[model samples]
Target: MRHIGKLLLLTSLLTSSLAFGQITADPEERGERGAQDPLRSRTPEGNPLPFMQRLRFGGGISGLSIGNPFSIGVSPVVAYQASERAVLGVGVNYVYTRLKLYDSAGQRYNFTANQYGGRVFGMYEIVPKIIPNLYAHGELESISVQDNYSGAGLPVNRTWIASPLVGVTYSQRIGRLAGINLSALYNLNYTTSSTQVYGSPWVLRISFF
Candidate 1:
């Protein structure tokens, strides 16, 4: 009878020990399993912001021109992604130039030069993440020259240059939705040199979009 009582007590103790062991080990084992899982969240840190909430803005502040004389330029831009791969924006540009030369006498003369413009641009990515990334680009630009440069020889104070450009763009994404843009484009309006905005038909631009 004493042996039977001892066996009963031992079994009860063993059951209680097993229950306690499970209660203690279950949490640690679950934690380890959670650590192994890639999508499990063990800590309080949350994910990044949503893509729509990620609005980006960028512009150019300085530029240098290399030609007959030394010139400098600056352009500013603002844009928002209209779709998954389309962006629409506007920008403003300003350029300044200076030249010092003398003709007959040894005197010094300073000349003023400038080219200012505003841009309305759109970019749609056709083939993304590949070689020769194709983008459909379009812009309507209004440029203004200084009053001194505007005479019978040149047009007027302001000139509008419109073009539908298609080209290859290379971009590097820094975070979720923000990135830098570098594009080499050809102007489709290759009618005459008088209608062109920049010097050449092929234009290269760097921006943050």
Candidate 2:
């Protein structure tokens, strides 16, 4: 009876030790378990987020009416979140521009042209924890425009122009899955000799996603 009693006490001690070890597991082990927990997988709208909630769509539009030249354009983008801090996207743009010009004899005339283009872009979050929604943006664009250097006077020929742009953006969340972003970019390929589509190297843009 004495030996049986000792055996039972030893068994109880072993079970208690095992339970205590499980209850007080290492913090890293607990974190790993928490990360895998399905109960914590939720979207901002309180719905269950899928394994890859990465695709996003956004775009911007601009209209300008200043006397000599008037222009209107639309840009639409489709993006994918590559990681926690990186995003990649592609976009298409169309602009209609009307210009008032003078001939060599000083006669005023109105000219209308259409500009169309496509771009691929990438963005990276800058110090996400410290700077919050700030991001660095880069893009490569190819546009079809009238060749102004082709003997001028209505530009009989069309050409493709390539522009490389770099900038920074500030993002603001408007809803659970929607956001607005403002970016100030500089064109790296801007030159006086080339057919300047944008007129300047600086571009300010506002977009929604």
Candidate 3:
């Protein structure tokens, strides 16, 4: 009789454990738990978000007027969120500049130029758990600019130049799908000469996404 009682106690403990596991392992319960997790990449229905939902579009515009020189530029970008921590994009650039110059003979003239380019870029989140809005950025660009080496009075020609840039971005989310970003970047291939398209190595951009 004692042996039968011991067997019954062991069977009861095993059955209780199996029942508890079944309760905890229900698919609906697990799905609800996963949906509540902020880090999980899922929709309200516990389905993965579509590709179009992960795409981001943004651009920046700039204008400068300082006496003899006037400049305006636009840069537009289309990006894809590859993961929670990474983004990849492509962009185009257009800039119009007009400058008043004095020839060697003391004659004043106007120089109008157009600079256009395209770039490929990538960004990675930096310590996202601690600072979710900060990102590290890198880009490779090829631009066409006026060949200033042709001398001040000669007819201008256009040439392609390559620029590599690295920087950081601070992004502020407006809602789930929109945000504003400020980026400060440095051009590694910048030169301090007339052939250079940009006057400065430092480039600051404010964009919307």
Best by TM-score: 3
List the pairs of residues colliding in candidate 1: none
Write one digit per residue (lDDT tens) for candidate 2, span 58-157. 6775222334455555667776656546768888876556666787999977666667789999989898547866899999888888655222455356
lDDT of 1 by residue, 1-209 (tens): 34334433543443232210000113453475553212111212333324434345565432243553344444556665554466677877655555456758887665555667787877777764353225677776556544443222554354444555667666565433345567777767654421223444565665554
lDDT, residue 23, model 3:
8
What's each prediction's TM-score? 0.54, 0.66, 0.69
Weakest 10 consecutive residues, lDDT, candidate 2?
16-25
Q: Show how many residue pairs clash in every candidate, following the order shown.
A: 0, 0, 0
Best by lDDT: 3
Clashes of 3: 0
Residue pairs that clash (backbone atoms under 3 angstroms), model 3: none
Candidate 3 per-residue lDDT over residues 1-209, each given as its tens digit = 34334433543443232210000123564465452213223454556556676667666652222344545556667777666567788888766666677879999876666678898989888986577679999988888888763335777878888888899988776535556778888889887532345556766766665
Question: Could you tell me the TM-score of candidate 1?
Answer: 0.54
After the best TM-score superposition of candidate 1, give how far the Cα of residue 50 lies from its true spot, in angstroms.
Answer: 8.7
Model 2: per-residue Cα lDDT at residue 127: 86
lDDT of 3: 0.63
Question: What is the overall TM-score of model 3 with all chains considered together?
Answer: 0.69
Rank the models by lDDT, top first.
3, 2, 1
